[model samples]
Target: MATFLHRLGRGAFRRRRLTLLLWAVVLGIAGAAAAGSGSGSGDSNVTLPGIEAQKAYDVLDEKFPAANADGASARVVVRAPDGKKLADSGPRAEVRSLLADLKDSSPRVAAVADPFVARTISADGTTGYAQVTYKAKATDLTDADHNRLDDALDDARGHGLTVEASGSALAPAAEAASSEAIGFLLAALILVVTFGSFIAAGLPLLTAVVGVGLTMGAITALTAALDLNSSTSALATMLGIAVGIDYALFIVSRYRSERAAGHEASEAAARANGTAGSAVVFAGLTVVIALVGLAVVNLPILTAMGLAGAGAVVVAVLVAITLVPALLGFAPERVLGRASRKKSGQESRPKTTASKLPAAERWAAFVLRRPWQVLLFSVLGLGVIALPATKLELGLPDDSSKPTSTTERKAYDMLAESFGPGFNGPLMLVVSGGDPAATKTAVAQLDRGVKDLTDVAAVTPATYNPAGDTAMVTVVPKSSPSSEQTKDLVHSIRDRAQGVETATGAQALVSGTTAMNIDVAAKFSAAIVPYLALVVGLAFLVLILVFRSILVPLKAALGFLLSVLASLGVVVAVFQWGWFQDLFGLQTTGPVMSLMPILMVGIVFGLAMDYQVFLVTRIREAYVHGADSRTAITEGFRHSGKVVMAAALIMTGVFGGFIGGADAMIKSLGLGLAAAVIFDAFVVRMTIVPAVLALLGQRAWSLPGWIDRRLPHVDIEGEKLGAIPAPSEPGHRDADFTPTH
Candidate 1:
């Protein structure tokens, strides 16, 4: 691997233009492809086991009528340049025009909100919106449904309306993705600023582009077999941008530094492969492992994210090591603007360290001087800033209370205000068995308990299936879906439901928005053990292999655990405690998104591992050269501190950028992820890691020499870096050059 990579790097230096053109073509195609995906129609792949999804679906079928009613979604708000927004009147003209046109066009338009009539337009003249009240028969609410709605909105926007839509799955997604694309590019610019070179800047984004393209393509393919959610699109984009850019940056910086130290391009690429490349491989894998942790929850959305993101990270790391080196080999002599380093050196030059490797002088000086004090203040600061997180509620208003300011939100608000919170009602428990009589008894048993539930407005007629042991029972809450009363009503049903496992063969599970969440939370709570255990176990093994020490893995795992717990604690205090609710602009009763903490840990763990890889790669390299663990730890922090911090800040900006978007889910996602990266990068990686390592000393890399010798050896170190293979490799180095200056 090293020999091949080394040869490839050397050739890259000789043929810069060809390499540039190849990547340009690749990017042009990717961009064109992405633009073509404007509506995100092609991305979907559900990884949840079929049985699980079947169970959820069966529950859906047993509950609400097997009809086509989509619970109401958020409404759209369109404003003109002067704040003159049209609602009922706006959608009226368009709807009527659309209807009149559909007379000549298609039937789908007439069925949608009756484009010419009531559901298509608001009563007011300032806003244009359509209300699609899914009659109790909406069996499918996929992205395509959302896309159709967006197309309708787009038709309106095309005629010179400034549009803001907040409803349907695609509505949030369109807002999320369009904004995210801009953010990824903004982050790319920030990355360029940090690297201070176009090629340097472009390389990470290039890797990111490749990663996203392939991930998007693969995800698009997955939709055929899996039930991948629309949210997965935004997820892939976010992860692709964040990991792709960071992963490439780590390697490129190392490669350029190696080239300058009098090593041939092949040798430099090899060394980069040996050090930064290896770290990247582990970091990327760790991300994959962390993502797989989401599988524990058994939710389709998370399961899909885990699989897709796992694939994305893999692509990112491979490209960082492969394509990046290929580009660097043919890059101009002065890659970092050193006119002479470009033209100098051969394979036999002295082994130079990765440039980001911390030097002993300044690092030891700083750590020894203020080690404990820095630790004290930073940890304290993290604790204080996290104090406000106590008010974070996990629940959002059900589909009934649209979380935006549009007509849908108003409709939801009106419903809640008029109908009490449980207008949606209790969860439907589906049973597929032989006991027609027993199913009847089980449902009756369930309805009686539900009637006994506190704060119930009423239980609707228990429509039962004698043949399938199926029953659809509705239990309306005494309060709105947004109220604590309704949540308690849901809790009562799950705890004391219509189906008793020990007594009856019938299975009764909750399927309403409220009930589904309670089940999701309970299920998520149960998975906590194995999720952490697997993450720790696998990450430990990877860390051990990479650093060649048991102690380092333990320390890495421990520090990461602390950071996650601290973050979770903040989540609990803010959302659970209901403190500072107004300050943060959150609901007092909303709990953290059930899937968020686990996802955060996985994502943050991966990111933490990334910084760990960057910081420790060269430090490990220093150690193999005989530096003591303390020196290595201190030096490692200094060496990669700047780069890791820069990446973290940029990612922080990228994740936080979405807060300005339309959906609260996106805002929460942005803020939560941003917080995790910022804390891990600046606090844990920079200060806490070194302190803990200094305290632990040599234990970090302790492996018996005999076992180490016997273990299967993987090479991270490369031999030649500046040249391509001798006519054997498929790709030739490009002649186009990027000024390293």
Candidate 2:
């Protein structure tokens, strides 16, 4: 593998101009294709195929077309500006006129319900809502269509009325453009400080952009043939930037080190590619494996996202191993700067001794001196942070979670204030099969039963289908949609409806946005354990195969688990418990997003393994060269620790930038990922790993002889590079030579 990579790297360096031209061509082609393909809008549907709630929703749509016609409708909410009652004749007339104008002006408007007559007016009579059904889902609407709707809503703002809109269509775009820009800027700053060269700092960012662009283009093309959620692109980009910059940074750092060691540019680049590039390949594969493991959950949305993320990482790896080396070859002199050039001229003789990072070496030695104490302290700290994870609740954020500046949040607040929090997410009860008369009776019975239950705000009269095979009912809870009480209410209604089924001889199925969210939460919660197990188990096995050490893999797995838990616990405390809601501008406390656990587990695990591979491979390499385990650990930390720390900070900055955005989910994701990177890099990789290795001694690298023989060798550290004799060395090392620690 090293030989192949060496040849590839040398060839790339030799053909540097051609390589640059090829990448330029690929970027242009991909950018054009992506622009032409139109990546399409996102899907907010969280329904799992074949689930009971999904089946119920399908039956409702099929049976009661008119009743469900506005399933995707947007609500235009108007409040009397002076706190005047909308029930007054003048204000009511103005509201009615506004609705009429909206209906007449927008071609996309399929129908607009009368606010007063439809009982859409709030109890206070100061606020009213009109339902506007569109020809298609809001996300599917064209730009012109959205502009028309926006204009129509704007017209209603006068006449002493405050108007806001909320629906699937009215959802604020993810608005990741600003966040991405900020992330890039911060990444550049970190790289510049680390490399002390403007040109060197920009290379990783450039490579990341190109690789991410190519992957996004492919994803856009795939969307034409398959269904992908809108969040997939944002998630993919997030992962892509992180891994891309880190991968390139590793190789570039190594190249600079080699050059500093007095190797020629071409030799340095090839050697860097052959060594750090191999670790990049292995780490990239681990990330891909963890992401692809999302398929085990059997949800198309998650599966698509996983594939997209994996694809981006693949591109990152490829760019790091090929394009980065080629680029480095063109300007190796600039990479190390003028100071390095002066030093090189003064010391023309080849460097015989490898330079070590003093700070990292001192830190490692300090930890090793008190191994048990360091390990215990680190474990206890992680444990405290992880405590909140046990009480973690999972639910998708509703429009209520949006920033107050967004139209969705305005509408959500208005509705909750005047009508009730439950008005934002009403449950749909579908009674199918049996006699049409019996279905009606069953619906009536279920409605009556649920109306008297706790949290019941209102139960709309049953509306039966024309075919008499299905009936529908709407149940509104007193609590907000994202509240725990609402989730419990949904369960209670379903349980109560079962009794109605026995009494009326009709099948009762509960579904709606709220119920769908409930089902989604349940599905993801059930899948989390298996998903974590699968990703962890797979990562453990991969580490074992690469490092050929049982204890190393076990230690890595435990550290990953701790890192993930601590990150999640912080999210729960902030987002779920509302410990500092005002700090983050969160308006309400609720469960963390349903998919956060699985997503975090997959991503953080891969990242944890990435550092594991980079750090451990160096230690293993030193050990393979006859260094004692303690010396190997110290030398490895000295070599790779600074690079690991730099990469972690950059990744944390990239993820943290998203918190400045309006989306609650993105904010949670940013916080969780940032926390994970910080804890893993500083605490786990730095303190716990070294301490554990020190205590384990030679046993840390022990692998059964028979299993080691059977396992296929994977040289992630490019050990073959060590076989090449240095220009100053007469031959390979003497068998009796042993360096003092």
The runs of at least 3 residues in candidate 2 whose Cα sits more than 4 Å from the true structure, single-residue gaps closed, are 65-72, 81-84, 171-177, 345-357, 434-438, 502-505, 582-588, 723-741
* Positional deviation of residue 681's Cα in model 2 after best superposition, in angstroms: 0.8
Give one digit per residue, the lDDT tens place, for model 2 in 505-610.
Answer: 8899888888877888788888888888888888778888888999999999899989999999999999989887888667677778887788888989889989
Off by over 4 Å in 1: 1-178, 185-189, 338-364, 376-397, 400-404, 424-426, 429-449, 464-469, 482-488, 494-509, 569-589, 715-741
For candidate 2, the per-residue lDDT at 266 reads 76
- Candidate 2 has its poorest 10 consecutive residues by lDDT at 732-741
Top candidate by lDDT: 2
The residue-by-residue lDDT of candidate 1 on 164-217, one tens digit each, is 444443334235346566667777777766666776777777767777887776
TM-scores for every candidate against the unseen true structure: 0.75, 0.92
